[model samples]
Target: MGTTGGLADDRALLGRTSTAERVADILRTRIAEGYFPPGTRLSEENIGGALGVSRNTLREAFRLLTHERLLVHELNRGVFVRVLTVDDVVDLYRTRRLVECAVVHGLGGPPFALDGLAGAVAEGERHARDGDWKGVSTANIHFHSELVALAGSERTDELMRGVLAELRLAFHVVDDPRALHEPYLARNREILDALRAGERTKSEQLLADYLDDSRTQLVEAYARRVADDGETPH
Candidate 1:
């Protein structure tokens, strides 16, 4: 399919607010949803037409995502979704550990607005039951996004939005979504349950351990895939 296939519906989102940032958001979500996998060249003409935005606005959006490390503009070449390196995988997890663990540790008490976390856990279970591992992976990302929301900081949420989207680029390298996402679903529930019970310390520990296991799993899988493709690890 072309880059802009079936993007007509997305035009409605920009009907009222057609800022470059909004366009960047729509593109970012598409990238995270695997609509535009790593290395796929983005067609500015097609995308701008489909989104009903001007070339200048689209370029600005591209620049924004490039800054976020989700897209890259090559000299004399078009912008493309970035293919993450093994080192990128490792660094992403390192950042996740620092940010996510800190968010969990900073929670003062129970009654942390956990509805979002619970919803994500349930969403993952639903997708798992339907044999949709990719859906499970997406929900797993959502679970963490909601977990970070516990901190109630808009800045942190915005930062993780980009980080998690970049992490999805790494996830695209994994051939087996079930293996990558299944184990973590239960672990997500464990963390949420602990939080609901006001066991902030236990939740933090579980989250720390969970991030460690996930980091290990992704790094190994991503490294092997990069090697198979003959790309040097950065």
Candidate 2:
């Protein structure tokens, strides 16, 4: 038997650096796409079948996600999606403020990539007018992502994506999604407008207020949910 297998080509065909990392990426996408909600138990058997990956590979991916704080493993039970607490929200927003505000201050010069910010703002408004709060939330994520991208730092963008994913879980706790997200659309636009006008100090202040309002909303929403969960019998 004579065969020259193109293992490297095969790897490229899989579209990943490794099977486990690929699986992890897919799972992350599922989380981002809202396919897996917070607190949902991720059955290895079901996920393995759906993804057509072996148990070992799936578990490896699970390990990666758990490390990323997107999933958590129970003592005896299996892995489940992480539900960010109010404290988690607080810490997450704290990180967001530090990073996002600094990025605004560190802007190199004019011709800033503020258009993405504007586009995200417009997207949110359009979604809100159409009464699609989830759409607005998605746009909000894009808005912040674009804000981080303004720094032109891949590491920062990667870090912020994970933070935003964690933040999304907190949003799931909101009772009125529309009410929670509606007020922020205009706020985002204002930030973009300030940046476009080259008002760094004003933009920075707007961003601080933006993060403060969001943190307060998420904290309150999470607190209410926690109280409700306490009342519900296990």
RMSD of 1: 8.3
Please give the CA lDDT of all the candidate structures.
0.90, 0.86
Residue-wise C-alpha lDDT for candidate 1, range 1-234, written one tens digit per residue:
889998897886564345889999999999998999888899999999999988888998999899999999888888999999877888998999999999999988667889999999999999999999999998999999999998999999998987899999999877889998999988999998899999999999999999999999998988888788885322
The parts of candidate 1 lying over 4 Å away from their true place are 1-18, 231-234
TM-score of each: 0.89, 0.89
Query: What is the lDDT for 9 in model 2?
Result: 56
> 56-91 in candidate 2: lDDT tens per residue?
888889999998899999889889888776778899
RMSD over all Cα atoms, model 2: 4.6
Q: List the residue pairs that clash in candidate 1.
A: none
- What are the RMSD figures for all models against the true structure? 8.3, 4.6
Worst 10 residues of 2 by lDDT: 8-17
Give candidate 2's TM-score: 0.89
